[model samples]
Target: MIQLYNVYKTYNNTPALVDISFIIKKGAFVFVTGPSGAGKSTLLKLLYRWENYDRGQVLVNGTNVGKIKFNRLWKLRRKIGVVFQDYKLLQRKTILENVAFVLEIVGADKKTIRFKAWEALKNVGLSHKKDAYPMELSGGEQQRVAIARALVNNPKILLADEPTGNLDPELASEILHLFEQANNEGTTVVFATHSQIILQEGNHAVITLKQGKIVDTRVVV
Candidate 1:
């Protein structure tokens, strides 16, 4: 579903990504693992269109991402769900409202919005915290809410960047399991993290990077 060919991204003549190329098939779970400043986040930014590459092609679901206009990019974004390590929730918005925001933007009816938001929260095991503000919840809870917000619309691909960085081992494991469950349900999952705790699951394709280049890539059976 996602392909990058000879991709090169530079800023102020300094390289962030250099000649990176890879293909992620539909219904697959993959990792973009790398150390700090290794362009892992830069790679994700390109996928989310936060930044554009200076050279090469990026295709998502057969559409050239580089050619997608801003207006059209919004539509493409609707098909993707992103979870950041920080959770990126609105401090003032209640948990329920946070998840409902997506539905509201897409013109979903109030009843459907509420139902879908609640279902997503339940999936993340945060049903009872629906009325609480983001600051009221613990870090793990906030991350779960973030996951719910990302999944509420049932996006085709879920992109997570260091999703478990701030949580304890147990919570991180739970979050990984949630990603696994989403993958099992056919939502293509692409995760970028340096956390070895998750690699033990041994059910994904891992692309290891060092200093902005792919050093090793292994597809697990």
Candidate 2:
């Protein structure tokens, strides 16, 4: 569950988001689409409190993300998984360790960590490459590893920003399908992308933005 009420955010003297308001219910799959500089990244950052908002409220699972104390930020982040466009994998760590690192940070037991990490890799069709370092894999493989890392903890919410931007069409479709599977398994998903190819699957909410404002919101189905 995520809610934003009359949110406003500005950078320097320029505004990035203006009067944005919307609600995403639990288990919902939502897409945020817009042109370049439309504030899609800003919106996602606000949800995770990666960037401070000058005004308005952002509530994730009923807790105000912006108002949380610095000490408790991890408590909020642990429940949400984020996939940046860059993949952000640790080049030195093997894929399995990269995914397992999340569980380790959460202090999961060794057995549980190994099992969940393996399962996450299998979910992305990359269990065979679990021992490969990030640099040893192709672009798409690295992306899959990133997805495995993001989903390894079974997060309550998933935020992806241009996750498939650098992949080929088929690879992009494969990546998007992985996100759909994650959403179907009950993790709410909010993806931000400018790609129209993602619209081919039309059974979810789509929020269009322009100049940092919510220009439109519709259920694609």
Candidate 3:
């Protein structure tokens, strides 16, 4: 679960998020939506502690995120997964290696890492490309690999920031289905997207923002 109370964030005296507040229940899937510069990305960053808010509180799974010591951030991040618009895959590493790197940093044994990494790729339907470098894959394939890497950790929460931004509608829909599958398996999902087609197709709760403030919260029917 995630909660934010009276949260405000500013960058160089400019507001990015103003008086934001909300609660996302455990295992729930929610969409954070807004146009460019509407603070959707900022909000996700706050949840994962990638960026600290200038004021207010953020709690994730009962931990006071703002109060966590920098040295201990791994404890908080270990339970969360993030996928970006740009599939931030390691170019020099094979797709399998890119996913295994996450487990490596988390200190999993080599045997466990190999199994989990392979399973994750298989989940994303990319196991056939396990030995391929990122540059060799298509855009959708690259994004699938990123998703595999993100989920390999079995994270409690998944934060996807405009993850389908670059893809065509067909590819985007495929990517969205992957997120839905993860949500169905019980990982809390907070997907930030600006695509109206995506918003209209889902029945999940949506938090809309504009000019750094929450403008609407509704569950699409």
Candidate 4:
């Protein structure tokens, strides 16, 4: 469902991704693994269109991502979900509001928005926290809120960058299990992390980067 062809990206003339190319089929779970500064995060940004490539093409379901118009960017983003280590929830909004806000932007009616938001929160085991503000939650709980917000719209692809970096081992494992469930339910997952624990736990496709180049690609057995 996603393909890149001869992709190149640079920052101030320093290459962040060099001739990167890959194809991720629908319903596949892929791990993007690399050390610090290995360009793993950069690659995800390019795929998500947060960082536009300087050259070549990025195609998602056959549409060129790099060339998407700003007015239509929302169309592209609505099909993808992103989870971050920082748990970028709106600090002042209640958990339900935070997740429902995305649906609101998409113009869904109030009843449907509330239903989907609650369902997503329940999926991440955070339904009870819906009425609480973000500051009142623990780190793991906050991250779960973030995940719910991402999944509320039922995105086709989920991109997570260092999603478990700040949580404890138990919580990290829980988070991974949630991601596994999402993948099993047909959301193509691209998770980028340097966590050795994550590397060891998941048996799936792995794409390893080094110094802005893809050094290894592990096909699922």
Candidate 5:
């Protein structure tokens, strides 16, 4: 679960998040939506502690995120998975290796790494392309690989920032389905997207933002 209370963040004295507060319960799927520079990405970064907040509190899974020590960030990050608009895959590494890289960073044994990496790729329906590099795959395939990498560790929370921004509608739908599947399996999902089609197609709770403030929170049917 995630909770934010009066969270305020500013960059160069310019507000990025203003008086933000929300609670995302376990096993919930929520969408964060807004126009460009609306602070959707900034909010996600705060959850993961990738960016520090100037004021207020952010609690993720009962841990005070803002108070965590820098060297201990991996402890917090290991419980969460994040995906970006860009695939962020290593161009030089094979798909399997990219997923396995996460496990390696977590210090998993070699055998476990191989098995989990393979299973993750299979979950994304990309096991057959495990040997391919990022450049060798299509845009959707690359994004699927990115999702596989994000899920390989079986994170408690999944944060996706505009993951469908670059793909066509059909491919975006497929990617969204994968997120839904993860949510069904009990991963709390917070997906940030600006696509109206995506918002209209979902029945999940939505949090709308503008100019760094929350404007609406409701279920889109």
Candidate 6:
């Protein structure tokens, strides 16, 4: 459902991605793995048009993302979800409102938004935290809130960047399992991380990058 062809991205004369090419099919759970400065995060940014390519094309579900108009880009983003290590929730909003933000932007009805948000929170095991503000939650709980927010919109693809970076191993494993569950339910999952524990999980299409180029591609069997 996602394809990148001869893509390149650069910043201040230094290349971040060099002529990268790859395809991710629908419903596939993939991991973009690499050491620091290997371009894993750069590639993820390009997927959502957060970073535009300096060369070549990025196609999402048959549409050239580079050519999508700004207004249309906003609409296109609704079809994809992103989870960041920082948890990006509104500090002042309750968990329910945070997850409901996505639906609100798309003009979903109040009843529908509340229902979907609650379901997503339940999926991430954060139902009881629904009325709590972000600052009142633990790190893992905050991250779960972020995940619930991302899933509430029922996106076709979910991109997570260092999702477990700040959590303990036990919490990290829990988050990984949450991602696995999302993949099982048909949301194409792409995660970027340098965690060794994540690399050992052994159930994903792994892509490794080195110095701005893809150095390895392996399907964990």
Q: Which candidate is the best by lDDT?
A: 5
In order, the Cα lDDT scores of the candidates are 0.91, 0.92, 0.95, 0.91, 0.96, 0.91
Tens digit per residue, CA lDDT, model 5, 3-45: 9999999998899999999999999999999999999999999
Compute the lDDT of residue 134 as modeled in candidate 4: 94
Q: In angstroms, how far off is 218's CA in candidate 1? A: 1.1
Taking the tens digit of each residue's C-alpha lDDT, what string does model 2 give over 29-97? 999999999999999999888997889999999999989988989999999999988999987899999
Task: State, as a TM-score between 0 and 1, how close model 6 is to the true structure.
Answer: 0.97
Give lDDT tens digits, candidate 4, residues 55-152: 98899977899998878888889999999989999998999999999999889999999899999999998888789999999999998988888888
- TM-score of model 3 vs. true structure: 0.98
* Weakest lDDT window of 10 consecutive positions for candidate 4: 40-49
C-alpha RMSD between model 5 and the true structure? 1.0
Candidate 5: where are CA atoms >4 Å away?
Answer: none
TM-score of each: 0.98, 0.97, 0.98, 0.98, 0.98, 0.97
Instruction: List model 1 lDDT by residue over 1-221, tens digit each.
Output: 99999999988988888888999999899988988889888998899798999999998888888888888888879889999999999988999999999889888999999999999999999999899999999999999999999999999999999999999989999999999999999999999999887876646899888877788998977
Where in model 2 is the C-alpha error above 4 Å? none
Candidate 6: where are CA atoms >4 Å away? none
Q: Per-residue CA lDDT of candidate 6, range 1-221, in tens?
A: 99999999999999999989999999998999999999988899888989898999999878899898877898679889999999999987899999998899999999999899999999998898899999999999999999988888889999999999999999999999999998999999999988979878747889999989999998855
